[model samples]
Target: MASKYRRGFDITRDSLRVFTREPSLILLPVLSLLAVGSAFAVLTAIVFQQGLVESLVTNDLYQYGALFCAIAISSSVATFFNAAVVHCAAQLFDGNPTSVRDGLAAAWRARRQIAVWAVVAATLGTVLYILDEKFGVVGSLTRAVFNLAWALLTFFIVPVIVLDERRSLRRQLRRSGSLFRDTWGESVSATLGVSFVFLLVALPGVALGAVGFFVLDGILATGALVSGGVIIVAAIVGSQTASAIVRTALYRYATTGEGVGPFENRDPDTVFPES
Candidate 1:
């Protein structure tokens, strides 16, 4: 357990280093946010025009359908950019220079696979949402468990899709699950570390925002709020970039029996124990 935590910290630290070296990586998450937001806006507009919004509000079935579509579209956009980020991270791992343009091109090339995976993800999300909405407490518990399982199973799907575009979506998902099972169960620890780092990064901004709301007034308060918002956005972008880098490194190590970044020179057995 201690070793797992140590490995998680190392992964997070190395991922941060990669992000520092290539600051442009942050743009991937930023663009992903913008793309998803735009898609949601468009979807909302279309749904409203078609009177689906009213139906969604009044009818459970319509609501679920709308929710599923929204989740699917947003998730798909995110998956596209995540794939691009993974592509760029892979290049960095290989000691090759890659631009955001190159990464975007790679993602575009694998658009079909991304689309299919997005549908799968969306379906899972919708089912979970429906479970929570229909079954009350029991459904909510089931949804939570399934959500975590889904996350674990598909953790490496983006890297697999980016690296091996020829594989079918089902195969890619299965491969991701298999690779994760073969790994040293570091996902929970790594996630906790990343979340802790994000909290640290966002703390100042949150403090400022709270101060602005409670103590500051007028222009000073507005300035503080704006600054806080910017800082929070930066923190989110940084966290996302680091996560992608770490995930890509993990996938590489899992598949090639080699490591990049801080993982280099580390024993594979130590990283992924045979227990």
Candidate 2:
């Protein structure tokens, strides 16, 4: 895979360059986070309308309903924002101008498909949640393996929803799975790159955390720790933006047979070598 396409770190570097070009891309993830928070707050109100702690402990329907809705909303919000990010990144890579508004509009256009996928995602999540909560170690292991496979299978879904336009959920899943199967090296490797990037950017926060406890004392240590937490959050946001960009780029390249962005004037994967 490394021999066939750009490696993860290289993809991360290029993705960061793309992020700098469209700095506002960072806002999508932030907004998604906030939206998910608000949604869960509303859901909490509904679930606790009877009795929060008591119902959670004794009311099976209320508890499961709350869990399902929470997972669905979270999945839907994440996919929505990821779609917007992909829209913006794809347009930019295609040498076109794109703004947050335009990206949002594109995602809105695909709301139907997103909603359907949300149901599917919610069911899977609820099942996994039940398994993990009830079966202990064996259930945890099963959940982990299923989660990984699901993630890999649907790796290109956000881009597919945004870029492909107006396909049924079944078709979209098929399309995404096929594309991922073909270019997994390019797609999954980008995650490794983003993870590497996160570790690099998060180091300052790690250092601050260490110093806060080990070197500083009392309130100053607390402040250092707080600041470190903020820095780590920022690093996460930045890495998420890069991940979105690389995801868009890899999907575009695999589908269109082009380079990642205008920054790279050649295809990310050049021609296949002689057989």
Candidate 3:
């Protein structure tokens, strides 16, 4: 138990150190959220203002098409910013300084590939949605299995998109899968470490929020709730940034046999071992 906590602490500390060194890294995820939220808002407006709700409900083809568009819009936005984050981390890990602009530029350079990937992901997502919505318990079970497989297979796709040479999406998928097959253990461990650390950070705020919502009253409750919300949001951003850093470092190490940024001076085996 103690060792587990220590490992989490070490991973969290290192990831945070990288973030402190490159504070602009936070902007990528923030931009992703804003863009995705806007896309969702537009879709909602179209549904309500344009009277697509009934069409969306009754027409299978139209409903699927709309869902596909919604998924593609949100997924593409998120993926593009993720590519930006990966690109920035790539530079940072290489001992070069970077900015939000540089990261955005890198992602833009790969815009076509990212769009193709978004379409691929959205198609699969739509099929899964249809399955779960139309097929009952068997569809739910199949969706769960397929979703897990999809996540594992595409684990390194963002960094691969940013860093790999222009290749077909199938090739990129193979590359990601190959890398995962080689480093799955270390990757999973480091991700869990980051998650565990952030969970610890989030718990106090969660408790405070629960208290404010249930056990407290009036201004005291409002203050507690607000405080908790801030803490939780900060924790979320921190975790997202930290997780990205970890993924980038692991990708760099797996592909190039070298660590970058926070993993620079430490033995890769100490944190992210080769298996």
* Number of the top-ranking candidate, with lDDT as the measure: 3
What are the per-residue Cα lDDT tens digits for candidate 3 across 1-275?
A: 66766776787788768757678778888878778878898788978998888988899998899989988998798889888888887786677999999999999999998999999999999999999999999999999999999988988888888898847999999999888887887778878888888888889899999999999999999999998987887777778777877888888888888867656776556664432
Segments of candidate 3 deviating more than 4 angstroms = 54-63, 204-227, 270-275
Model 3 lDDT-worst window of ten: 266-275
lDDT tens digits, residue span 1-275, model 1:
66655565666777877756677777889998888878888887888788786787899888878878887888788889988988988888888888889899999998988888888888888888888988999999999999888888888888999996447977888889988888735554455667677878799999999999999999999999989988998888777777777778778888887878656656544554534
- Point out where model 2 deviates above 4 Å: 1-7, 44-50, 136-138, 203-218, 262-275
Q: Stretches of candidate 1 above 4 Å error?
A: 1-10, 19-21, 44-54, 265-275
Query: What do the candidate models score in CA lDDT, each in turn?
Result: 0.80, 0.79, 0.84
Ranking by TM-score: 3, 1, 2
Candidate 3: Cα lDDT at 259:
68
**Model 2, global lDDT:** 0.79
lDDT of 2 by residue, 1-275 (tens): 55434444566677777757778777887888779889988877865685677877787776777788888899899889888988888887777888889889998999988999999999998899889989999999999999999998888888888898648888888888998888876566557757876887799998998899899999999999998887887787777777787777778777876676522654544322222
